[model samples]
Target: MTDQELQTLVEKVSQESFRQPFCHNARFNQRLKTTGGRYHLQSHDLDFNRLVFEKYGTAELIKVIKHELCHYHLHLAGRGYQHKDLEFKQLLKKTGGSRFAPLLAPVVFQVYQCQQCQKMVKRRRKIDTKKYVCGGCQGKLKFLKTIEA
Candidate 1:
């Protein structure tokens, strides 16, 4: 969904779930990696990871919005909004918000093969064949990159 649509959804969930109006902006942030969403105390704005919707769908998105709204509302009301706070925990439970961000897809790893021994090696980082040798026979490794995932 577009950022405008996301903003509307956040505002709607805020009102429905928290009984509070989210006056600040809420937008999809492509740069957000692991977190489902974030509430900025300085601006009172909410930034959600677009991947959350893409990977988990609307239901998951709503949960994330609710989670962020808890932070937004509690902080605005001058109550404890941190994760460890009792008020935050109670509000999150009342709203059925996710306690933690959803897990992201595992990163694909590159695989290399030794042509001589036909041994395979897996690595998250790229390896220089010139500097690295195969473990099996100390044979030279060649790039046979394939995603482990």
Candidate 2:
């Protein structure tokens, strides 16, 4: 969904779930990694990872919205908005927000195998087999299939 749609959704969820209106901005931040959403303390703006909706669908996105809304509403009211606080925990549980985001797929890594010792190696970037040899036996290394960790 677009940023406009996300803003509307955050506003709607804030009203419906928290009984408070979200006055600040809400937008998708492509730079966000791992976390499903973030609530800026100073700006009161909410940022959601677009990949959440793309991978997990709208239901999960709504949960993430609720999670961020918990932070937004609590922080605005000057209550204990931190995750460690009782108020935050109670509100989050009451709102049915996710305590933790679901893990995304592991990163894929390039695999290499030693021709002599048959030792396996994984690297984030492609390495030249001609230059790099197996550490075990100084044997020739062959590029293997890439696999996810």
Model 2: per-residue Cα lDDT at residue 101: 81
The prediction achieving the highest TM-score against the true structure is: 2
> Model 2 scores what on Cα lDDT?
0.91
True-structure RMSD for candidate 1: 3.6
Residue lDDT tens for model 1, 16-129: 998778899999887899899989989999999999999999999999999999999999999999999999999999999999989875777989999899988899899899
Cα lDDT for residue 45, model 1? 93
- Residue range 72-126, candidate 2, lDDT tens digits: 8888889999989999999999999999887755788999999999999999999
Estimate every model's Cα lDDT from 0 to 1.
0.91, 0.91
Give candidate 1's error at residue 43 in angstroms: 0.4
Q: Residue 5 of candidate 2: its Cα lDDT?
A: 93
| Count of steric clashes across candidates, in order | 0, 0
Candidate 1 stretches with Cα past 4 Å from truth are 107-149
